[model samples]
Target: MNILNTIRERRSIHTFKDQEVNTELLEEIFTYGSYAPTHYMTEPWKIKIYQEGGKTAFVDAILASYQRIGMLKMDGSPKSVKMNDSMKKFLLEIPHHAVIYFEKKEDLIRYEEEYASVCAFIQNVQLAGWEHGVGMLWTITPYMHDPQFLKDIGLNNEKVKIAAVMQLGYPDRVPKDKGRSPIQDKLEIITD
Candidate 1:
Protein backbone atom coordinates (compact mmCIF):
# COMPACT_ATOMS: atom_id res chain seq x y z
CA MET A 1 0.00 0.00 0.00
CA ASN A 2 1.09 3.57 -0.62
CA ILE A 3 2.43 5.42 2.43
CA LEU A 4 -0.13 8.20 2.14
CA ASN A 5 -2.98 5.72 1.79
CA THR A 6 -1.80 3.77 4.81
CA ILE A 7 -1.58 6.96 6.87
CA ARG A 8 -5.09 7.95 5.86
CA GLU A 9 -6.60 4.53 6.51
CA ARG A 10 -4.90 3.72 9.81
CA ARG A 11 -7.13 4.04 12.86
CA SER A 12 -6.67 3.51 16.55
CA ILE A 13 -8.20 0.08 17.12
CA HIS A 14 -9.06 -1.05 20.64
CA THR A 15 -10.63 -4.35 19.61
CA PHE A 16 -8.79 -7.16 17.82
CA LYS A 17 -9.21 -10.75 16.65
CA ASP A 18 -7.58 -13.81 18.25
CA GLN A 19 -5.34 -14.53 15.28
CA GLU A 20 -1.59 -14.16 15.84
CA VAL A 21 0.44 -11.65 13.82
CA ASN A 22 3.08 -13.12 11.52
CA THR A 23 6.55 -13.13 13.15
CA GLU A 24 8.29 -11.85 10.00
CA LEU A 25 5.81 -9.01 9.67
CA LEU A 26 6.34 -8.01 13.30
CA GLU A 27 10.10 -7.95 12.75
CA GLU A 28 9.69 -5.81 9.66
CA ILE A 29 7.62 -3.33 11.64
CA PHE A 30 10.33 -3.12 14.28
CA THR A 31 12.95 -2.62 11.62
CA TYR A 32 11.01 0.40 10.39
CA GLY A 33 10.79 1.66 13.97
CA SER A 34 14.54 1.34 14.44
CA TYR A 35 15.17 3.54 11.44
CA ALA A 36 13.59 6.67 12.92
CA PRO A 37 15.91 9.68 13.08
CA THR A 38 17.79 10.60 16.25
CA HIS A 39 20.28 13.26 17.27
CA TYR A 40 23.98 12.37 17.42
CA MET A 41 23.12 8.96 16.00
CA THR A 42 22.15 7.82 19.51
CA GLU A 43 19.56 5.16 18.78
CA PRO A 44 17.90 5.09 22.19
CA TRP A 45 14.67 3.26 21.45
CA LYS A 46 14.09 -0.27 22.76
CA ILE A 47 11.07 -2.52 22.28
CA LYS A 48 9.93 -5.64 24.09
CA ILE A 49 7.58 -7.77 22.00
CA TYR A 50 5.06 -9.89 23.90
CA GLN A 51 2.80 -12.37 22.08
CA GLU A 52 0.90 -15.64 22.62
CA GLY A 53 1.57 -16.87 26.19
CA GLY A 54 3.75 -13.85 26.75
CA LYS A 55 0.77 -11.59 26.10
CA THR A 56 -1.14 -13.13 29.03
CA ALA A 57 1.82 -12.72 31.35
CA PHE A 58 2.30 -9.12 30.24
CA VAL A 59 -1.35 -8.26 30.80
CA ASP A 60 -1.39 -9.92 34.22
CA ALA A 61 1.72 -8.04 35.26
CA ILE A 62 0.19 -4.75 34.11
CA LEU A 63 -3.01 -5.38 36.10
CA ALA A 64 -1.03 -6.50 39.13
CA SER A 65 1.10 -3.39 38.96
CA TYR A 66 -1.96 -1.17 38.72
CA GLN A 67 -3.51 -2.92 41.69
CA ARG A 68 -0.31 -2.61 43.63
CA ILE A 69 -0.41 1.13 43.02
CA GLY A 70 -4.09 1.50 44.02
CA MET A 71 -5.16 2.52 40.53
CA LEU A 72 -7.82 -0.19 40.31
CA LYS A 73 -10.66 0.45 42.71
CA MET A 74 -12.83 -2.29 44.16
CA ASP A 75 -16.08 -3.00 42.35
CA GLY A 76 -18.72 -0.22 42.68
CA SER A 77 -16.27 2.25 44.15
CA PRO A 78 -16.88 5.99 43.63
CA LYS A 79 -13.41 6.83 42.31
CA SER A 80 -13.76 5.54 38.79
CA VAL A 81 -10.65 3.79 37.59
CA LYS A 82 -8.99 4.98 34.38
CA MET A 83 -8.32 1.39 33.33
CA ASN A 84 -11.37 -0.69 33.93
CA ASP A 85 -11.90 -4.45 33.78
CA SER A 86 -13.07 -4.21 30.18
CA MET A 87 -9.86 -2.55 29.10
CA LYS A 88 -7.83 -5.12 30.95
CA LYS A 89 -9.88 -7.89 29.39
CA PHE A 90 -9.28 -6.42 25.96
CA LEU A 91 -5.55 -6.19 26.64
CA LEU A 92 -5.38 -9.79 27.77
CA GLU A 93 -7.03 -10.96 24.58
CA ILE A 94 -4.78 -9.05 22.18
CA PRO A 95 -2.36 -11.11 20.07
CA HIS A 96 0.65 -8.88 20.84
CA HIS A 97 1.91 -6.12 23.14
CA ALA A 98 5.00 -4.01 22.53
CA VAL A 99 6.61 -1.98 25.29
CA ILE A 100 8.63 0.91 23.86
CA TYR A 101 11.38 2.52 25.89
CA PHE A 102 13.88 5.31 25.28
CA GLU A 103 17.25 5.50 26.96
CA LYS A 104 17.82 8.99 28.30
CA LYS A 105 20.79 10.94 27.06
CA GLU A 106 22.95 12.95 29.47
CA ASP A 107 22.24 16.26 27.79
CA LEU A 108 18.76 17.72 28.17
CA ILE A 109 18.53 18.51 24.47
CA ARG A 110 19.58 14.97 23.68
CA TYR A 111 16.84 13.65 25.96
CA GLU A 112 14.21 15.59 24.03
CA GLU A 113 15.70 14.41 20.77
CA GLU A 114 15.50 10.79 21.90
CA TYR A 115 11.83 11.21 22.84
CA ALA A 116 11.01 12.76 19.46
CA SER A 117 12.82 9.90 17.77
CA VAL A 118 10.76 7.37 19.70
CA CYS A 119 7.55 9.11 18.70
CA ALA A 120 8.59 8.96 15.05
CA PHE A 121 9.45 5.30 15.53
CA ILE A 122 5.97 4.57 16.86
CA GLN A 123 4.38 6.41 13.93
CA ASN A 124 6.42 4.30 11.58
CA VAL A 125 5.25 1.11 13.27
CA GLN A 126 1.61 2.21 13.12
CA LEU A 127 1.82 3.00 9.42
CA ALA A 128 3.64 -0.25 8.71
CA GLY A 129 0.93 -2.20 10.53
CA TRP A 130 -1.75 -0.42 8.54
CA GLU A 131 -0.18 -1.59 5.31
CA HIS A 132 -0.38 -5.19 6.55
CA GLY A 133 -4.07 -4.95 7.51
CA VAL A 134 -3.10 -4.97 11.18
CA GLY A 135 -4.15 -2.51 13.87
CA MET A 136 -1.96 -0.92 16.52
CA LEU A 137 -2.99 0.99 19.62
CA TRP A 138 -0.50 3.08 21.56
CA THR A 139 -1.16 3.21 25.31
CA ILE A 140 0.65 4.59 28.33
CA THR A 141 -1.14 3.39 31.41
CA PRO A 142 0.07 4.64 34.80
CA TYR A 143 1.18 1.12 35.66
CA MET A 144 3.63 1.28 32.78
CA HIS A 145 5.48 4.10 34.53
CA ASP A 146 5.70 2.32 37.88
CA PRO A 147 9.29 2.17 39.06
CA GLN A 148 9.21 -1.48 40.05
CA PHE A 149 7.63 -2.52 36.81
CA LEU A 150 10.21 -0.50 34.87
CA LYS A 151 12.95 -2.31 36.76
CA ASP A 152 11.35 -5.66 36.04
CA ILE A 153 11.35 -4.76 32.35
CA GLY A 154 15.11 -4.12 32.56
CA LEU A 155 14.69 -0.39 31.98
CA ASN A 156 17.17 1.73 33.87
CA ASN A 157 15.50 4.57 35.75
CA GLU A 158 18.70 6.54 35.58
CA LYS A 159 19.00 6.21 31.82
CA VAL A 160 15.75 5.03 30.28
CA LYS A 161 12.04 5.89 30.45
CA ILE A 162 8.91 4.14 29.24
CA ALA A 163 7.60 5.90 26.13
CA ALA A 164 4.57 3.80 25.26
CA VAL A 165 2.90 0.37 25.26
CA MET A 166 1.66 -0.58 21.80
CA GLN A 167 -1.01 -3.28 21.32
CA LEU A 168 -0.84 -5.11 18.00
CA GLY A 169 -3.24 -7.49 16.22
CA TYR A 170 -5.70 -7.89 13.38
CA PRO A 171 -8.75 -5.72 13.95
CA ASP A 172 -12.08 -7.45 14.42
CA ARG A 173 -13.72 -4.55 12.60
CA VAL A 174 -12.38 -1.97 10.18
CA PRO A 175 -13.46 1.55 11.13
CA LYS A 176 -14.53 4.22 8.67
CA ASP A 177 -11.99 6.94 7.91
CA LYS A 178 -12.13 9.96 10.17
CA GLY A 179 -11.66 13.37 8.60
CA ARG A 180 -8.71 15.57 9.44
CA SER A 181 -8.29 19.34 9.70
CA PRO A 182 -7.24 21.27 6.60
CA ILE A 183 -3.46 21.64 6.28
CA GLN A 184 -3.84 25.28 5.19
CA ASP A 185 -5.31 26.15 8.59
CA LYS A 186 -2.17 24.96 10.37
CA LEU A 187 0.52 25.71 7.83
CA GLU A 188 2.40 29.02 7.56
CA ILE A 189 4.82 30.52 5.06
CA ILE A 190 7.59 32.82 6.23
CA THR A 191 9.01 35.65 4.16
CA ASP A 192 12.06 37.77 4.88
Candidate 2:
Protein backbone atom coordinates (compact mmCIF):
# COMPACT_ATOMS: atom_id res chain seq x y z
CA MET A 1 0.00 0.00 0.00
CA ASN A 2 1.08 3.54 -0.74
CA ILE A 3 2.14 5.69 2.22
CA LEU A 4 -0.82 8.08 1.94
CA ASN A 5 -3.40 5.30 1.80
CA THR A 6 -1.65 3.41 4.59
CA ILE A 7 -1.72 6.51 6.78
CA ARG A 8 -5.45 7.04 6.17
CA GLU A 9 -6.55 3.41 6.55
CA ARG A 10 -4.44 2.36 9.52
CA ARG A 11 -6.38 2.04 12.73
CA SER A 12 -5.62 1.30 16.38
CA ILE A 13 -6.81 -2.28 16.60
CA HIS A 14 -7.98 -3.64 19.95
CA THR A 15 -9.44 -7.01 19.01
CA PHE A 16 -7.06 -9.50 17.45
CA LYS A 17 -7.51 -12.86 15.78
CA ASP A 18 -6.40 -16.04 17.64
CA GLN A 19 -3.20 -16.26 15.67
CA GLU A 20 0.48 -15.77 16.33
CA VAL A 21 2.13 -13.29 13.97
CA ASN A 22 5.43 -14.65 12.62
CA THR A 23 8.50 -13.45 14.49
CA GLU A 24 10.47 -12.89 11.29
CA LEU A 25 7.68 -10.73 9.90
CA LEU A 26 7.63 -8.67 13.10
CA GLU A 27 11.41 -8.19 12.86
CA GLU A 28 11.08 -6.94 9.29
CA ILE A 29 8.39 -4.48 10.32
CA PHE A 30 10.54 -3.20 13.20
CA THR A 31 13.45 -2.87 10.82
CA TYR A 32 11.31 -0.48 8.83
CA GLY A 33 10.48 1.28 12.08
CA SER A 34 14.19 1.89 12.66
CA TYR A 35 14.29 4.24 9.70
CA ALA A 36 12.39 6.90 11.63
CA PRO A 37 14.35 10.12 12.22
CA THR A 38 16.54 10.26 15.34
CA HIS A 39 17.98 13.47 16.78
CA TYR A 40 21.77 13.38 16.41
CA MET A 41 21.45 9.68 15.54
CA THR A 42 20.92 8.71 19.20
CA GLU A 43 18.32 6.10 18.15
CA PRO A 44 16.86 6.05 21.62
CA TRP A 45 14.10 3.46 21.39
CA LYS A 46 14.32 -0.01 22.92
CA ILE A 47 11.82 -2.86 22.92
CA LYS A 48 11.06 -5.95 24.99
CA ILE A 49 8.63 -8.39 23.40
CA TYR A 50 6.43 -10.74 25.42
CA GLN A 51 4.47 -13.46 23.69
CA GLU A 52 3.01 -16.93 24.34
CA GLY A 53 3.86 -18.12 27.84
CA GLY A 54 5.88 -14.98 28.51
CA LYS A 55 2.69 -12.90 28.55
CA THR A 56 1.61 -14.50 31.83
CA ALA A 57 4.26 -12.69 33.89
CA PHE A 58 3.61 -9.39 32.12
CA VAL A 59 -0.15 -9.68 32.70
CA ASP A 60 0.41 -10.48 36.36
CA ALA A 61 2.54 -7.39 36.75
CA ILE A 62 -0.13 -5.24 35.11
CA LEU A 63 -2.82 -6.56 37.45
CA ALA A 64 -0.55 -6.03 40.40
CA SER A 65 0.06 -2.45 39.30
CA TYR A 66 -3.67 -1.86 38.99
CA GLN A 67 -4.26 -3.20 42.48
CA ARG A 68 -1.43 -1.14 43.93
CA ILE A 69 -2.89 2.01 42.38
CA GLY A 70 -6.43 1.08 43.55
CA MET A 71 -7.81 1.02 40.04
CA LEU A 72 -8.70 -2.61 40.67
CA LYS A 73 -10.18 -3.63 43.97
CA MET A 74 -10.56 -7.31 44.63
CA ASP A 75 -12.04 -6.53 48.02
CA GLY A 76 -13.67 -9.94 48.27
CA SER A 77 -16.66 -8.51 46.42
CA PRO A 78 -17.97 -10.81 43.69
CA LYS A 79 -18.21 -8.01 41.14
CA SER A 80 -14.66 -6.81 41.67
CA VAL A 81 -13.30 -10.33 41.53
CA LYS A 82 -15.13 -11.00 38.26
CA MET A 83 -13.87 -7.80 36.72
CA ASN A 84 -10.31 -8.64 37.63
CA ASP A 85 -10.62 -12.12 36.21
CA SER A 86 -12.18 -10.81 33.01
CA MET A 87 -9.44 -8.26 32.52
CA LYS A 88 -6.76 -10.85 33.08
CA LYS A 89 -8.28 -13.17 30.50
CA PHE A 90 -8.67 -10.38 27.98
CA LEU A 91 -5.06 -9.32 28.28
CA LEU A 92 -3.71 -12.84 28.11
CA GLU A 93 -5.52 -13.47 24.84
CA ILE A 94 -3.57 -10.84 22.95
CA PRO A 95 -0.90 -12.39 20.70
CA HIS A 96 1.99 -10.08 21.48
CA HIS A 97 3.07 -7.18 23.67
CA ALA A 98 6.02 -4.91 22.98
CA VAL A 99 7.21 -2.62 25.75
CA ILE A 100 8.97 0.37 24.21
CA TYR A 101 11.34 2.44 26.30
CA PHE A 102 14.42 4.63 26.23
CA GLU A 103 17.15 5.58 28.66
CA LYS A 104 16.42 8.68 30.73
CA LYS A 105 18.38 11.68 29.60
CA GLU A 106 19.27 14.08 32.39
CA ASP A 107 19.11 17.28 30.38
CA LEU A 108 15.61 18.71 29.91
CA ILE A 109 16.00 19.56 26.23
CA ARG A 110 17.72 16.24 25.44
CA TYR A 111 14.94 14.30 27.15
CA GLU A 112 12.26 16.02 25.07
CA GLU A 113 14.18 15.40 21.86
CA GLU A 114 14.66 11.71 22.66
CA TYR A 115 11.00 11.31 23.57
CA ALA A 116 9.97 12.90 20.28
CA SER A 117 12.31 10.64 18.33
CA VAL A 118 10.86 7.55 20.02
CA CYS A 119 7.34 8.74 19.23
CA ALA A 120 8.28 8.98 15.57
CA PHE A 121 9.74 5.48 15.72
CA ILE A 122 6.48 4.19 17.18
CA GLN A 123 4.46 5.76 14.37
CA ASN A 124 6.78 4.15 11.87
CA VAL A 125 6.22 0.74 13.51
CA GLN A 126 2.45 1.16 13.27
CA LEU A 127 2.55 2.20 9.62
CA ALA A 128 4.92 -0.59 8.64
CA GLY A 129 2.87 -3.17 10.53
CA TRP A 130 -0.29 -1.99 8.76
CA GLU A 131 1.16 -2.84 5.36
CA HIS A 132 1.67 -6.45 6.48
CA GLY A 133 -1.95 -6.87 7.66
CA VAL A 134 -0.84 -6.71 11.27
CA GLY A 135 -2.45 -4.35 13.75
CA MET A 136 -1.08 -2.56 16.78
CA LEU A 137 -2.60 -0.63 19.67
CA TRP A 138 -0.18 1.83 21.22
CA THR A 139 -1.30 1.95 24.82
CA ILE A 140 -0.16 4.40 27.48
CA THR A 141 -1.91 2.87 30.45
CA PRO A 142 -1.58 3.80 34.11
CA TYR A 143 0.30 0.58 34.84
CA MET A 144 3.14 1.93 32.72
CA HIS A 145 3.79 4.55 35.37
CA ASP A 146 4.08 2.09 38.23
CA PRO A 147 7.66 1.59 39.38
CA GLN A 148 7.00 -1.94 40.57
CA PHE A 149 5.58 -2.83 37.18
CA LEU A 150 8.76 -1.63 35.52
CA LYS A 151 10.85 -3.71 37.89
CA ASP A 152 8.63 -6.72 37.24
CA ILE A 153 9.36 -6.31 33.55
CA GLY A 154 13.10 -6.19 34.35
CA LEU A 155 13.50 -2.53 33.48
CA ASN A 156 14.93 0.02 35.86
CA ASN A 157 12.32 2.75 36.34
CA GLU A 158 14.93 5.23 37.48
CA LYS A 159 17.07 4.74 34.39
CA VAL A 160 14.50 4.38 31.62
CA LYS A 161 11.28 6.00 30.47
CA ILE A 162 8.48 3.88 29.10
CA ALA A 163 6.93 5.27 25.93
CA ALA A 164 4.23 2.66 25.34
CA VAL A 165 3.24 -0.97 25.58
CA MET A 166 2.09 -1.97 22.12
CA GLN A 167 -0.43 -4.77 21.71
CA LEU A 168 0.15 -6.40 18.35
CA GLY A 169 -1.55 -9.08 16.24
CA TYR A 170 -3.69 -9.67 13.16
CA PRO A 171 -6.89 -7.68 13.48
CA ASP A 172 -10.14 -9.39 14.38
CA ARG A 173 -11.90 -6.08 13.80
CA VAL A 174 -10.94 -2.61 12.58
CA PRO A 175 -12.72 0.41 14.04
CA LYS A 176 -14.23 2.95 11.67
CA ASP A 177 -12.31 6.15 11.11
CA LYS A 178 -13.14 9.03 13.42
CA GLY A 179 -12.05 11.70 10.99
CA ARG A 180 -9.65 14.43 12.00
CA SER A 181 -10.12 18.20 11.92
CA PRO A 182 -8.56 20.13 9.07
CA ILE A 183 -4.87 21.00 9.45
CA GLN A 184 -5.70 24.68 9.18
CA ASP A 185 -7.49 24.52 12.51
CA LYS A 186 -4.26 23.71 14.35
CA LEU A 187 -1.64 25.12 11.99
CA GLU A 188 -0.09 28.58 12.30
CA ILE A 189 2.03 30.09 9.54
CA ILE A 190 4.57 32.84 10.22
CA THR A 191 6.37 34.53 7.37
CA ASP A 192 8.27 37.63 8.38
Candidate 3:
Protein backbone atom coordinates (compact mmCIF):
# COMPACT_ATOMS: atom_id res chain seq x y z
CA MET A 1 0.00 0.00 0.00
CA ASN A 2 1.13 3.56 -0.65
CA ILE A 3 2.52 5.32 2.44
CA LEU A 4 -0.02 8.14 2.24
CA ASN A 5 -2.89 5.70 1.86
CA THR A 6 -1.68 3.66 4.80
CA ILE A 7 -1.43 6.79 6.93
CA ARG A 8 -4.93 7.87 5.95
CA GLU A 9 -6.47 4.42 6.48
CA ARG A 10 -4.80 3.61 9.78
CA ARG A 11 -7.05 3.98 12.81
CA SER A 12 -6.59 3.50 16.51
CA ILE A 13 -7.97 0.01 17.00
CA HIS A 14 -9.27 -0.97 20.42
CA THR A 15 -10.63 -4.41 19.62
CA PHE A 16 -8.05 -6.98 18.61
CA LYS A 17 -8.29 -10.57 17.39
CA ASP A 18 -6.62 -13.50 19.14
CA GLN A 19 -4.26 -14.26 16.26
CA GLU A 20 -0.60 -14.19 17.27
CA VAL A 21 1.76 -11.75 15.52
CA ASN A 22 4.99 -13.33 14.29
CA THR A 23 8.34 -12.00 15.51
CA GLU A 24 9.53 -11.11 12.01
CA LEU A 25 6.63 -8.71 11.50
CA LEU A 26 7.30 -7.11 14.87
CA GLU A 27 10.97 -6.69 13.94
CA GLU A 28 9.90 -4.89 10.78
CA ILE A 29 7.69 -2.53 12.78
CA PHE A 30 10.50 -1.75 15.23
CA THR A 31 12.94 -1.18 12.44
CA TYR A 32 10.60 1.41 10.97
CA GLY A 33 10.29 3.11 14.35
CA SER A 34 14.08 3.15 14.77
CA TYR A 35 14.46 5.05 11.53
CA ALA A 36 12.48 8.07 12.75
CA PRO A 37 14.56 11.26 12.64
CA THR A 38 16.21 12.09 15.93
CA HIS A 39 17.91 15.32 17.00
CA TYR A 40 21.69 15.21 17.44
CA MET A 41 21.50 11.54 16.45
CA THR A 42 20.91 10.78 20.13
CA GLU A 43 18.29 8.17 19.22
CA PRO A 44 16.98 8.49 22.76
CA TRP A 45 13.79 6.53 22.18
CA LYS A 46 13.46 2.92 23.41
CA ILE A 47 10.62 0.48 22.95
CA LYS A 48 9.86 -2.38 25.33
CA ILE A 49 7.96 -5.07 23.46
CA TYR A 50 5.55 -7.21 25.48
CA GLN A 51 3.72 -10.22 24.09
CA GLU A 52 1.82 -13.30 25.35
CA GLY A 53 2.37 -13.54 29.10
CA GLY A 54 4.38 -10.35 29.03
CA LYS A 55 1.27 -8.29 28.28
CA THR A 56 -0.39 -9.68 31.38
CA ALA A 57 2.66 -8.74 33.43
CA PHE A 58 2.55 -5.19 32.08
CA VAL A 59 -1.16 -4.77 32.81
CA ASP A 60 -0.73 -6.07 36.31
CA ALA A 61 2.19 -3.80 36.98
CA ILE A 62 0.29 -0.75 35.69
CA LEU A 63 -2.76 -1.58 37.79
CA ALA A 64 -0.64 -2.10 40.87
CA SER A 65 1.03 1.22 40.32
CA TYR A 66 -2.33 2.94 39.98
CA GLN A 67 -3.49 1.30 43.19
CA ARG A 68 -0.47 2.77 44.93
CA ILE A 69 -1.28 6.26 43.64
CA GLY A 70 -4.84 6.17 45.06
CA MET A 71 -6.32 7.46 41.82
CA LEU A 72 -8.40 4.29 41.62
CA LYS A 73 -10.86 5.87 44.05
CA MET A 74 -11.78 9.41 44.94
CA ASP A 75 -12.20 8.41 48.57
CA GLY A 76 -10.29 5.46 49.95
CA SER A 77 -12.63 2.53 50.38
CA PRO A 78 -12.56 -1.24 50.14
CA LYS A 79 -14.68 -1.19 47.00
CA SER A 80 -12.48 1.44 45.36
CA VAL A 81 -10.63 -0.08 42.42
CA LYS A 82 -7.43 1.38 41.06
CA MET A 83 -8.52 0.93 37.48
CA ASN A 84 -12.12 0.97 36.32
CA ASP A 85 -13.47 -2.43 35.37
CA SER A 86 -14.10 -1.35 31.80
CA MET A 87 -10.59 -0.01 31.40
CA LYS A 88 -9.17 -3.27 32.72
CA LYS A 89 -11.42 -5.07 30.28
CA PHE A 90 -9.47 -3.62 27.36
CA LEU A 91 -6.05 -3.61 29.05
CA LEU A 92 -5.73 -7.36 28.91
CA GLU A 93 -7.45 -7.71 25.55
CA ILE A 94 -4.62 -6.64 23.30
CA PRO A 95 -2.16 -9.16 21.77
CA HIS A 96 0.92 -7.02 22.38
CA HIS A 97 2.12 -3.84 24.11
CA ALA A 98 5.06 -1.61 23.26
CA VAL A 99 6.11 0.78 25.98
CA ILE A 100 7.92 3.75 24.44
CA TYR A 101 10.51 5.69 26.42
CA PHE A 102 12.88 8.56 25.67
CA GLU A 103 16.08 9.51 27.43
CA LYS A 104 15.93 13.02 28.84
CA LYS A 105 18.45 15.66 27.87
CA GLU A 106 19.84 18.03 30.46
CA ASP A 107 19.23 20.90 28.08
CA LEU A 108 15.56 21.83 28.50
CA ILE A 109 15.33 23.21 24.97
CA ARG A 110 15.97 19.74 23.53
CA TYR A 111 13.23 18.01 25.51
CA GLU A 112 10.44 18.85 23.09
CA GLU A 113 12.62 17.89 20.14
CA GLU A 114 13.22 14.43 21.66
CA TYR A 115 9.49 14.09 22.30
CA ALA A 116 8.72 15.01 18.69
CA SER A 117 11.16 12.30 17.56
CA VAL A 118 9.33 9.78 19.73
CA CYS A 119 6.02 10.89 18.24
CA ALA A 120 7.47 10.37 14.77
CA PHE A 121 8.61 6.93 15.82
CA ILE A 122 5.08 6.15 16.95
CA GLN A 123 3.67 7.30 13.62
CA ASN A 124 6.20 5.10 11.81
CA VAL A 125 5.18 2.10 13.89
CA GLN A 126 1.51 2.69 13.22
CA LEU A 127 2.12 3.15 9.51
CA ALA A 128 4.17 -0.03 9.33
CA GLY A 129 1.48 -1.93 11.21
CA TRP A 130 -1.16 -0.70 8.79
CA GLU A 131 0.94 -1.78 5.82
CA HIS A 132 1.26 -5.24 7.36
CA GLY A 133 -2.48 -5.58 8.16
CA VAL A 134 -1.86 -5.14 11.86
CA GLY A 135 -3.62 -2.74 14.27
CA MET A 136 -2.22 -0.31 16.81
CA LEU A 137 -3.35 2.11 19.56
CA TRP A 138 -1.16 4.63 21.37
CA THR A 139 -2.19 5.50 24.95
CA ILE A 140 -0.77 7.90 27.49
CA THR A 141 -2.33 7.14 30.84
CA PRO A 142 -1.45 8.34 34.31
CA TYR A 143 -0.19 4.89 35.25
CA MET A 144 2.28 4.91 32.38
CA HIS A 145 3.81 8.18 33.60
CA ASP A 146 4.09 7.38 37.26
CA PRO A 147 7.67 7.65 38.46
CA GLN A 148 7.79 4.44 40.47
CA PHE A 149 6.07 2.49 37.72
CA LEU A 150 8.48 3.89 35.15
CA LYS A 151 11.39 2.80 37.33
CA ASP A 152 9.89 -0.64 37.88
CA ILE A 153 9.55 -1.06 34.13
CA GLY A 154 13.34 -0.52 33.81
CA LEU A 155 13.01 2.86 32.11
CA ASN A 156 15.94 5.08 32.94
CA ASN A 157 14.33 7.60 35.27
CA GLU A 158 17.49 9.65 35.51
CA LYS A 159 17.71 10.00 31.76
CA VAL A 160 14.40 8.89 30.30
CA LYS A 161 10.64 9.35 30.48
CA ILE A 162 7.75 7.12 29.49
CA ALA A 163 6.24 8.49 26.28
CA ALA A 164 3.38 6.12 25.63
CA VAL A 165 2.08 2.56 25.78
CA MET A 166 1.13 1.32 22.32
CA GLN A 167 -1.10 -1.72 21.85
CA LEU A 168 -0.72 -3.89 18.77
CA GLY A 169 -2.60 -6.80 17.22
CA TYR A 170 -4.85 -7.96 14.39
CA PRO A 171 -8.02 -5.94 14.26
CA ASP A 172 -11.29 -7.53 15.30
CA ARG A 173 -13.12 -4.90 13.25
CA VAL A 174 -11.99 -2.60 10.45
CA PRO A 175 -13.32 0.92 10.76
CA LYS A 176 -14.25 3.22 7.88
CA ASP A 177 -12.05 6.20 7.14
CA LYS A 178 -12.73 9.29 9.20
CA GLY A 179 -11.88 12.16 6.93
CA ARG A 180 -9.57 14.92 8.08
CA SER A 181 -9.93 18.71 7.84
CA PRO A 182 -8.62 20.37 4.70
CA ILE A 183 -4.95 21.26 4.99
CA GLN A 184 -5.34 24.57 3.22
CA ASP A 185 -7.28 26.11 6.09
CA LYS A 186 -4.81 24.81 8.69
CA LEU A 187 -1.62 25.97 7.05
CA GLU A 188 0.00 29.42 7.20
CA ILE A 189 2.54 30.59 4.62
CA ILE A 190 5.08 33.32 5.42
CA THR A 191 7.34 34.78 2.77
CA ASP A 192 9.26 37.91 3.73
Q: Is candidate 2 or candidate 3 better by TM-score?
A: 2
Q: Write the per-residue lDDT of candidate 1 for residues 4-81, one digit (tens) a residue.
A: 788788999887998988899999988887788877787778889888777666776777677779877556554444
- TM-score of model number 2: 0.97
- 92-177: candidate 3 lDDT, tens digit per residue: 77888888888787877799999999999898989998899899888988886677787777765677788888988999987777
Report the lDDT tens digits of candidate 2 across residue range 69-188: 999996979999998999999999999999999999999999999999999999999999999999999999998899999999999999999999999999999999999999999999
lDDT of each: 0.82, 0.95, 0.82
User: Which scores greater on lDDT, model 1 or model 2?
Assistant: 2
Off by over 4 Å in 1: 74-88
User: Candidate 3 — worst ten consecutive residues by lDDT sum?
Assistant: 74-83
lDDT of 1: 0.82
Q: Quick one: best TM-score, which candidate?
A: 2
